[model samples]
Target chain A: MVIINGEEQNAAGLTVAEVLARGDYNAARVAVEKNGLLVPKREFGGAVVSDGDVLEIVAFFGGG
Target chain B: MIPAKEEMLAALKERIGGDLLEKFQSSAAAVCGLGGLGSNIAVSLARAGVGRLFLYDFDDVDVTNLNRQQYKASQIGMSKADALRENLLEIAPYTEIISQKVKITEDNALPLLKDADVICEAFDKAESKAMLCNLVLEKLPEKYLVAASGLSGLGTGNSILTRRVSERFYICGDGESDVDTCGTLFAPRVCLCASHQALAALRILAGLYDV
Candidate 1:
């Protein structure tokens, strides 16, 4: 099980892309971080998730 | 008798306390995007006697920006950076205002933001904000970043707030509100958000980083 956005989930061996898709997050709008290191948007497809890995997804909204 | 410039500065120091005032006078901030949020943040920081400000904007002062942004009708044709510089100088003449008329991107953000103690993210687009925040957090980890993400139409003033994302990142506004849902942009709410950003920056500069 891996932690995504602080929620526990069974995501071992899943790529970042699969994890994002499972969570229904819009790929184009969010910046993802894995264990405090940024996973550049382009490499999401190849970065795999491991047990207990922490992921933080931040979505930006326009205003200021 | 007319007071000397030093006398005036001394008066401010007496009001804010010598140590705090000195911190404000020594700290530098880089404000990206001289729109409503950026311009207002710059204005407040300048008025508070912040020592140096680096202003960036690629757009000219459009007539449409007057509704919320800090610009005058007479200054419509001028570049946003130049017009904002004029505004800041009028408030705090001693402040070092470095205005640049160019777009900031991932490729150039580091060099542009490297010197400032704080980076103010006031871009109007989500993509632009994300790009700057990501690049800054990844590359320039030492600098504190204050970003505003909401404050659309005339919603309740209390809904807008300042939130700390992490040790180095802080965001102002309701975090979830936007122009799409709030309808249109207005001055009061937008300025409120700008104040939050400015206050957060000042706190960071003064070493009040508990938030």
Candidate 2:
């Protein structure tokens, strides 16, 4: 299981993008950090998760 | 007549205590947008007697911005950076305000934000907010960043809060609502988020970094 935003999830084999999509997270509005490293916007598609990896995603919205 | 800068700051020092006042008077913060969030964020930093503030914005103060922004109606045609500086000067004359009339992009983001002790991301658009936050987290990992999101519409004030994403990165907002579907941004809600950013920045300045 991969840890995402402090929750355990069975997403070890999926790409970062795939994992985020499952949670209904808006890709354009969120920044992702993988295993203590930030995954740039372009790399989200290529970056895959591993067992016990941690992902921190913060989504942004409009209006200040 | 208004009190001189020294006397006013002295009273301020007495009120907040000398150590905190000294810390505030020695710290510097940068506000990346000059709208509702940025304007109020800048004002709070000034009122706390932060030594210097860097204000960035490229737009003019339009009538539409008057609802939530700190700009005066008469300053409509003025640049947001200059107009905010004018208001900040009156609020905290001793706080050195640097008004940079430019949009923060990937190219200029690092250089422009390198000097601040803490950087507050208060842009009005999601794209701009993401751009600034991503770049800062990736490139300038050492500097503290306090960003806002999900502060649209008339959601409960209790929903808005400051979340610590990492050791140096913090985000303040509901983490759910979006203006696209939430309708127009209300003044109290925006101000609440702005205040979160302001207070978060102050806490960072004072070595209080939780939440």
Judging by lDDT against the true structure, name the best candidate. Answer: 2
Stretches of model 1 off by over 4 angstroms after superposition: A1-13, B1-4, B180-183
Write out fnat for all predictions, comma-separated: 0.65, 0.87
Give TM-scores for every candidate, taking all chains together and pairing residue i with residue i.
0.89, 0.97
Worst 10 residues of 1 chain B by lDDT: B1-10
Pairs in clash, predicted candidate 1: none
Model 2, B1-211: lDDT tens digits are 6789889889998888999999999988999999999999999999988999999998999999998999999999999999999998888877888888998999988888888999999998898998898999889988999999988898799999999888888899998888887778888999999999999999999999887
Per-residue lDDT of model 2, residues A1-64, tens digit only: 9999999999999998998889888788888988766899999889999998989998888887
The top-ranked prediction according to TM-score is 2
In order, candidate lDDTs are: 0.86, 0.91
- What's the true lDDT of residue A8 in model 1? 91
